[model samples]
Target: MLQHPKYIVRRLQPADAPSFYAAVRESVDELTYWMPWCSKDYSLSDAEAWMQSTSDMWAAGAEFPLGIFDATTGEVLGGTGVNHINRAYRIGNIGYWVSSKRTGQGIARFAAHESAVLGFGELGLTRLEIVVLTHNRASQRVAETVGAKLECEARNRLYFQGSPHSAFVYSLVPEDVR
Candidate 1:
């Protein structure tokens, strides 16, 4: 478990599949812009398979997938990850989602901040970017709250719910945190 009192950002486990599926089900519609893979009728089997693949990637040092947990009860609160790690460039992108019931309470901001610290201090990543759907002010706030600077507008960058939408690309460097 991570050191944060409100939440723990830890790697995904096979045992978390059920809770993960439950959270996904609870937030399916609201997460369309927040979650890149949000879609119809996500299942427990899919969560299990994803956990396996993600765990393997973390073990192989190829990527990191973190599940935010309630610090006291160890309940899976949501999911976050650093995918497409580029060692040569010392960079990675952060993607995350929070349970709808858990939103607007600073949980996503807390998790994303801790993840950013881990990426820089432990993983030695020098650059991180968070891409938020143009209209997702809540998520954009999370990105800015974590010290990432608004970089550019990525036109037609995301395809969510069968429609092309633009994204605001926010970026951070090690110095930004300091």
Candidate 2:
């Protein structure tokens, strides 16, 4: 787990389903815009299943999905993680999202940075990537804040609700974080 003055970052647990569900429910509209898995019908069961899947992935060393929480209140802030891990290449992709109310608070930036630290420091990863939808300026800003370089733009790189979207690919190496 990673701790910061304003928030705590950690792996998801089954017990977190309720709060996670609530957070998603509150921001479903905004989240559905970019998150393929998010929808108006998302349920607590889905959150629990997601938590279970994340746990399994962690055990298999395939991916890490972390939850960000309010440091003091323990409220679910959002999530960030290193996914699509490619062990052979020592590379992983970083992704993050915050509740609508938490936007503009720097929470996403902090969580993203911490995820990079975990990826490069603990996971022995050599490179990290952040893919942002072309229209997602907020996410692009987070990648920039963490020193990720704009690598290129790809067409139909991200899929949301079964449709492809163009995205800007940003990359960060260990030295970029340092």
The best candidate in terms of TM-score: 2
Which residue pairs show collisions in model 1?
none
Q: Give RMSD to native, each candidate.
A: 1.8, 1.2
lDDT of 2: 0.92
Candidate 1 deviant stretches above 4 angstroms: 32-36
Global lDDT of each candidate: 0.84, 0.92
Give per-model TM-scores. 0.91, 0.95
Tens digits of per-residue lDDT for model 1, 1-178: 3567678888888999898888888888876545656666778888898889888998898888899988888888898878778999999988778999998878888778777877888789999989888888888999988889998999998876678889999998888774
lDDT of 2 by residue, 97-178 (tens): 9999889999999999989999999899999999998998999999999899998999999885678888999999999986
Q: After aligning candidate 1 to the native by TM-score, how far in Å is the CA of 150 from where it should be? A: 0.6
Best by lDDT: 2
> Which residue pairs clash within candidate 2?
none
